[model samples]
Target: MTDNISAYKFDWPPITVEGYKKAENKVIMVFNLDVRTPAKVDHVIQYVVGRTVWCSLNSPVNVNILLSFDFRGQGIIVTKTQSLKSELLRLLNKANINNQVSIDFLI
Candidate 1:
């Protein structure tokens, strides 16, 4: 870390999804959960988390992903966007996420 590159030292996502949109790339999400059902959460995390990170790490360049999470700890509110295309949602058709826990994507 050097002071020569101040602007270069910035947060990923760049305050928006602009980079991903401009680069024409997709995003991957990684979350550490503290919910009621540990087994179910572990199943989803193991299956899908870090998938995009693995892809980007081995690629030429311009491949990127936003590493984000939703914390549903004690007395916390879950407000994941209704529009998010969750990996667990797509793959875990029979998981019954709604009933498994109180987690949800708010509209």
Candidate 2:
């Protein structure tokens, strides 16, 4: 047993989400969205984050928020649950941005 331990090599732990997925038992859901304009991007992100926080606080299921936006009108939202995705879709509909917003998950 001592000889076997000596033959093994130790490695650094993973630091990113992808690393965590491989090293630990975890799953991350990613959703892709497109907003037609920079202003709309800002608005959509604000709405999503705000609602996610509010819902998480009031609801039993907490949403993990990880959002990335490009000035070029593309964005990606990373969440542990699909609730955030549903919220975003509802927001687009309520804001009358359905024509401008596109979800890759739905496409």
Candidate 3:
């Protein structure tokens, strides 16, 4: 068992995939967005809530206690090698979710 473990030790690169299904050239990616605080301007942050939130304005007082706000978003991306995966990647990375964005891929 110990010898076999050492033999199986390997790191897979981002461009490499294993156990992929035949005739399937695409892959699925999941994006998780979590926003803890509202945006500085009211109509700026419109992804999940899709509307101008009143608590977007920063104040000395804690907005959580003074007012209620919705801040969080999630979505999935699916595409093949021929499609524009870079566009989807740009959107996922550009989302201003207060450093609460994540992406996962399955092979």
Candidate 4:
């Protein structure tokens, strides 16, 4: 599991939900940064373990997802925020992400 995370090229910056909404368009999925190595990816996933969730006034409406990781593996991991919507949340939980990290929903 630790090997699956990614590290940022620069210092890990805080991704504010407010800032994401203001900056991006209607699309909610954004890969803010990418990692070039597996070790770096593991570092990122490990760092996200304790990160808190931020939401806007939209609540269960609009969502912003940030998938900051290194593409070391093959298939899609679905790290972005919007993909974790209520419906997707249930699916992920069923897929066994409940013990992974605290998921956040943005408005």
Per-model TM values vs. the true structure: 0.29, 0.30, 0.19, 0.28
Q: What RMSD, rounded to one decimal, does every model reach?
A: 15.6, 19.0, 22.2, 10.2
lDDT score, residue 14, model 3? 36
Q: Rate the local accuracy (lDDT) of all candidates.
A: 0.36, 0.36, 0.25, 0.36
Q: Candidate 2 residues 1-107, lDDT tens each?
A: 12122111223233122111333332232334455455555555554444333333332232233333332333433441244446555653544331322232432
In candidate 3 the C-alpha lDDT for residue 13 amounts to: 23
Q: Which consecutive 10 residues in model 2 have the weakest lDDT in total? A: 1-10
| lDDT, candidate 4, 57-94, per-residue tens | 22234444443332344343455334323333443344
Residue-level lDDT of model 3, residues 29-49, one tens digit each, is 222334223332212223312
Residue pairs in candidate 4 whose N, alpha carbon or C atoms collide under 3 angstroms: 5-41, 5-42, 6-40, 6-41, 6-42, 6-44, 7-40, 65-81
Residue 94 alpha-carbon offset, candidate 3, angstroms: 4.1
Best-first order by lDDT: 1, 2, 4, 3
Task: Write the residue-wise lDDT of candidate 1 on 1-107 in tens digits.
Answer: 11122222223342322224345454444454553454645443443323332434434355445544455444334433222235444333233222111123312
Worst-scoring 10-residue span by lDDT in model 4:
50-59
